[model samples]
Target chain A: MTNLQETKPLMHLLSATFDSLQSATPEQLEHNPFLQLRKQGLDALARTGLPTPRDEEWKYLNLAPYIRHPYQLPAGKESLSHLPQILPITTIPVVFFNGLFQPHLLSPVHGVTVTSLAQLLDRGSHDGTALGEQEHSIGQLLSPEDDPFVALNAALLHQGALLHITQNPSQPIYLASITQSDQPLFVNLRFAIRLSTGTAATIILDLRTLSKTAPTFHNIVSEIWLETESALTLIFLQNDTAQNYGVLTTRIAQTARSRSRLYTITAGNGMVRNTTSVQLNEPEAETVLYGLSVLRDTEVADHHTAVEHLAPNCQSSELYKSIVADQATNIFNGKIFVHPEAQQTNAYQSNHNILLSDDAQVYTKPQLEIFADDVRCTHGATVGQLPQEAVFYLRTRGLPETVADVLLLHAFAAEVYEQLPLEPLRAWIDQQLSHRLFDIVDLAADRKLVDLQFATS
Target chain B: MHNAKQPLLTIENLHVAVDDKQILKGVDLTIYPGEIHAIMGPNGSGKSTLAAVLAGREDYTILQGRVFFDGKDLLEMSPEERAAAGLFLAFQYPVEIPGVSMLTFLRTALNEIRKSNGEEPIDTRTFLQRVREAAQLLELGNDFLQRAVNVGFSGGEKKRNEILQMAVLRPKLAILDETDSGLDIDALKIVANAVNSLFGTIQSYLIITHYQRLLNYIEPDYVHVMYDGKIVRSGDKTLALELEAKGYDWLRSETLSSIELPSTTT
Candidate 1:
């Protein structure tokens, strides 16, 4: 990190990207407030450079190849046929392909307003709605100084969706970011969600790739603002192929009596990092984070989360489980901070992992900082294989070892998805889990399991 | 309903060890179809070890001996294969498997056994009917089938669940190892009645216990006394009453004097 030789490749890439951005579009610069933010982000990127393994947060993942790869903007035209099959669980869909918003695919909902950040900035006045009202809340919450990738995302941010929810939508909004390209490309995406007072909404952010050719590097950042008495249930689904790398960052700011339930599910291969940070700025706010990673082959899924209790009577709980097979790797780093004024706060964090093979790897760390004397905080982590006694018990009932292993692993992961509000989505996940566990999809087994779950519930 | 000449299970000179410590030493026994044989012994006399070894528990190492089930090499099969071959061992302590409903477990197991027998998987209707009948016979509520396998089940409920599984599976030889250990009088009678109801000429039972309290509810044709890793003496149902009155201490002394005698032929 100290030597100039170590930073040369990243520096070269950064300089090239900065020059390209400076010359790419001179016409859209007059009324764009984000242009200044992008310039500042580029300058910051030039100064700070890229992060190496020496950084504590990036210790488990090596980004040398991802950072040094020569990538360009996607040039190939995409079509509707390229869209991967999404389960028909949500009524509304907001689609983004290769970092560009597709207005034609968006379905209008009654209680929600979806507009691009660029359009709002074109109006050039604070209309007391969307990003114009908050005045660059995107850059404020997703500060470029937070991480080198965040700085890169800000430097390259162009088309971002600004969604404002004013009431309980009848159906969940499926915000899908799909990537498919013939050549190596960089896909940068940003989004902001603002929930009005007393409103409740569920949002699903589905990030997937349809291309299996050149690697697609996705850098996505999302900021959320929850007003008083508002609730948000957000599901972040990462289902990219192995030929992709991504960094997904989500930051949430909650007001008084607001609640947030965030779920991060990784069911596909590739290298991805998901970072979520929630801040309770007012009293009586609560946040719960649930994560499950089912990976195999050469896939790598890394998750880092932070929950900060800045006010009294705020509560936070986090549970993350992983089933890693083959030589795949999984990492979890969670931090809970209870400030001095955050008295009577209750925080809990736990991470559990099951390695399907000896080659599978898992690294988990739970960090808690409680300054308040009256706070209750607990954190723990465990990494193990399938319980042998349970396996033998199942085997005694005439199930083969492979079936026993699959059943136990499925049960281990069921805790995360069982609480899903939508039954169809839960059933879809059950089918997906069966496909991930066995080479051939066992539809009968999946059907039986679906019946069991429904009948028992 | 009895096949006296053709033996269903034969264990000859069986010796089993766990972690190189011999648990079963030169044990010999045989049971015919349509027979109910009980093994009454002291706490550490290798009663459960025999049952576990018969059910293909891999922890135990067989230093010497052979076991035959229906004239096949029982020791050579995996636990699942043994189960498919109609050998079931009601565990001394049934392990709890959370998140797998009893209905799913039973159906999957029955389907696997059926597959091994070159038969199609049981239909849903038949499976549910059999499960309901077995649950009712064991006095287990329908809610029990919806619960995770043995999860949060009491000791008595776990034993009853084991009987329910035996009833649904209908194994040729069902080894109940200390199933009566943690049951009250009422649950004991329910479980015994379930076992008795399932008994037939083709299905045999090997009940292992430390006391003779359960023998009153379910009569056994023959009773064997196991001591210090060997079947020291075996007799009829009257022997259970004799052991209940005189206790295992009297047999210990008598066994000491008869140690050099050749093992029983019958």
Candidate 2:
């Protein structure tokens, strides 16, 4: 948008695709309310094409090589034979295969309503008044112009889900967005979750790819609205294969006395960037954000978050930890803004990282802007290796060097994941993390590095 | 201990250094089975260095020396190997490891030792029972075992926790490095009694301290005085009383004037 010449070619290609896709719409869907929203998204993308490293938000990430590849739109009818092995999946998820929602695969949870966007658009055309009201609410939250990825997702929005909760579900609702493609593909998906007054619900957004051969780029945008006294727990498990890329942008707004907790665990070999923005719309709202990324190989995961305290007496606490090994990278940037009227707001944030190898890297930044004089805000960031003293202490207890390393790494991440409200999910995360750490340890052991260090006289 | 009994630990001409600064200069000591040897020294006299080096701490550089434990070359083994070989050092400052509970640490340690010995893992019930009995010896409750290892513990509590670990590990040779540093009289007696109760024919102890008060509770068979990184005197229990009465300064001047060789040679 600011006269950046490098992003011109892909921008033109995406623009032409959007125009052709719009022209191919069925005659019955021509009067759909999403038509206007799609046009708005296309215009926003035209103004600001694919983000480059020059952009402030994408400073540490370089997507030029990734975006340079010619990616065709998803075929809309990929097979779902690989659904059973998508994850060690205990619960049947609301499946979105190739960005298309499958209603038949969704199990009906208590007091929750799941509506496909395609169905909603079809009904909106018949009853324009109902769709018109929905459009207004969705439009305000999905401000596509805020981010290039959000705009891209909105422009190519093929299918999505809208979840409404009226009571607390007995188990967490699993929304799985999966991509299974042999050819390079581009997928865009959207979701909006609304909780009624005094209602509470937990959602697990698990994103992955069935195939690890061809690269699939998934851009997702989610909008969440918590009413007065409602609580929402959102956990994002991005465990994609090595050939996939993901960008998730979530916007959440909380009303009076509402609570929200977000946990982001990215253990994927592919690259992922998660941007979350929370608006404390009313007083007495509380939010907790926790993230842990155990990355290895050439993978990269970046988390960018912003919390706004617009009302008084709001509290927000954030802690993000990363265990990066090999040549991988993890980046965290957290921003907390307290307005003048938001007095008595208490905000705290901390980011800690452990680099096992010399090439492993972590970049962390904490930005706090407070205009109120009566607010309490504290932020800290630390990047260090494993403490040698602690390692020796563990080793002296009859644990081998590799075993000692694994135990310490597990203990380092346990501080964040121990707060998980769901026991099964917590155990799953613990197992997943243990597998990743053991991989690292086994690799180290294979290199005979442990032997070289502790060689006897 | 009779002369016919084989030695549990033997340190000969042990010269150790840290970052090029020599700490233990030609230290020699030998302990037989069922013997308790107390080494009294002032601060920085290398008493702690001997304990650390024996436990296979890698921070110190072993310039010239050899250590044998149960007839095996101790210097050639890694820390875990040394640990599994029944060598334990009660650290001067017990480390605080957050997020790792005392129960998990001990269980893991015991299992690893058992694993290396080709033994099966103990059942959870038996393990918990053992931990309960060990905790009771230190007057500690089960809640204390559930908390993070040594985290937020007082000085006395940390020292007692070390003894609790010693009780569970049941090492053949235990080296206590300044275990009585920050203990009150009541905590001192409790800790000393726990050590005494754990000791038997198969267990020997090397108690390192700055004061002889701990020896009053857990009596030592031999008392050695360390001065300037070397053992200056070795005698029976009355030697500890003499040193307590005369203080370390007397031993320092006496060693400087007489320049007598360590009694290990005799």
Candidate 3:
């Protein structure tokens, strides 16, 4: 890997970012756990460097455009002037701006303990207990040796959230992260969640941008641990702008009879990459991963998922759908691994894509590796265009060309959206998807046609 | 009779080609209000091509000639425009629109046609009432309206759905393109009964078929035999029976010998 990085020559693009680590406050560096973790992360990144197209996992995605420039750490200010409108729901929300946790935006909660990681580090610093041991245990859940982006995010981690659910929560909890800055900025965020035994809850993580043209780069890492017989639903909503770049890595581990479902909906961004990993460590554990991406213009979106069944009688299923239009591009890579001891494992994976224009492109790879002899595993992929016969059929019914196209596209996407567990959230996401897909001009013209027909009839 | 009145549709020396290959050559026909005209032909006799060209399908190109519907240039209108102008074609194979329900599809079509005629759109209650009546006429259950358009329908069900659409939209000129090709005897009777119930003095039909069996149920006032993209013979309903009894070879040989070409039919 070192020799490969030396040959690429673009690996130095991220080395310049390490020098900016001195910008951290002296007090933060004084903490032994924070200082050691940052040093270890930096060393790991220096060895592996950035990924190139030659890498098997990144064959379809290139990171040269994102890593060419050196970004400075943003010193975010406490400005409530540009906050997004709060969702109209009975839940608690924790807001962060440019990787800085805002205390004023934290809402009250009754059944869970929520705090910032910065605050935890501060408390550990004054208590004189060995915090490094605890940090090392949590860091074991992620493998930075295999991914350079994970190392980069860990090296620059500053502010994030820590949630501990001890009992079944009465309401959902939301973590809203807002990225905005006047100049080019790089932000790293970390989240650690622990759901205790027999507890059930839902958590929504929303990544949003205030300005559409702000040049911001965000690196986020989340690790979730589900105890025995617990159930949790984790939803990630990525709604950035055309000028921003983002990388998200999620790691989840399940115990005996535990259940977890991860849902991701990606819409707006110039470039976005998502990596999700889940491990069923005990028997009878199950996990489900579902995602939908709608891209237009010259935007690019990529999703890479890995699910490992390490114990017997475990199950995992994954389904992802994408629609690309104009000159946009998309990629989906899903891998399922069944260990030697994972007998009777039932794993299924599928990826479906729709290209709406001549220039649109999609690359899908669904892979499976089963070591057990008695396992039922299947994986497949499909890429296609909207049926011309269906479009002409609708046109013969008096629907205009654009209306017919939009209707068919919506139907293709509804297969994934209709499966959302929450009713209100599904409705909200459906509205957002409609607004993103149809322009105001097309919608207004359709309305006028409808009115004309009504008036004449 | 009504044949003395102004014709509802007039085709003059129409020549059409699909994929740059001529499929229709010098076709001439006319239909008046309140007349049922049936065109019978053998396979590859340009029967479906005529229906497709009338419906404004983009696959075909008009090499020459013209078509006028209700004294307006038909070739100049788009498919949707033609539909709104009270021209309906019951497709030989109905398309499957997976997400759109039958009720929504029918309602949209009916409303658009009504709008084009300078009338107000039908309210929900009235539309539902009309749909119930049409469904009952076609012997379809009420639950069928909620299913996706032709997604899992059998051949007979799909044919019935097309007639149900026609009943709701109420087009002035109805063109049935091989509607009885894949139907069983019972389904054929049901479809024939539906079309007969919807006929009126102001409406006309251009039923294109290959068998003389369909005319036995919905009798036609005129029967034309198409051979090599042209109508070679014309007569009353007895012509269909004569052709059915003697087979299309008799007409093919008659037309081919007149044109000085060897008969290709066996």
Error (Å) of candidate 2 at residue B153 is: 0.8
lDDT of 3 by residue, A157-186 (tens): 567777778888787777777766666667
Q: What Cα-based lDDT does every candidate model obtain? A: 0.82, 0.82, 0.77
- Give the runs in model 1 whose Cα sits over 4 Å from its true position: A1-32, A75-84, A118-132, A440-457, B1-5, B260-265
A1-457: candidate 2 lDDT, tens digit per residue: 2342435534533554355445756763465546656666777876877788899999998887566667766654555644565344455367777767767776677788787776776454533222224542555675778998877776666567778888887767888877777777676777888888899888988877777677877788898888899999999987657777888899898999999999998887488999999999899999999999999998899999999999999999999999998999999999999999999999999999999899998999999999999999999999999888887887787878877887788888878878888776686687777777878777443432222111110
Accuracy of chain B in candidate 1 (TM-score):
0.96
Cand. 2 Cα-lDDT: 0.82
Residue range B137-236, candidate 2, lDDT tens digits: 9999889998888999999999999999988888898899999999999999999989898889228999999999999998998999888888988998
Highest-scoring model, TM-score:
2
Candidate 3 chain B lowest-lDDT run of ten: B257-266
Ranking by lDDT: 1, 2, 3
- A1-457 in candidate 1: lDDT tens per residue? 1222434643433454466456646654543547656766676676777677788998988877665666775444454533456875745677778766777776678889888754555454423244547543677787888887788777776657888898789998888777777767677778889898999999998877777787778888998999999999998877557877788888999999999998888878488899899999999999999999998887889999999999999999999999998888999999999999999999999999998788899999988888899999998899998898988888888888777777778788888878888888877777677667654222344334432232343
Poorly placed runs, candidate 2 (over 4 Å): A1-17, A20-33, A79-92, A107-110, A121-136, A443-457
DockQ winner: 1
TM-score (C-alpha, index-matched) for candidate 1: 0.92
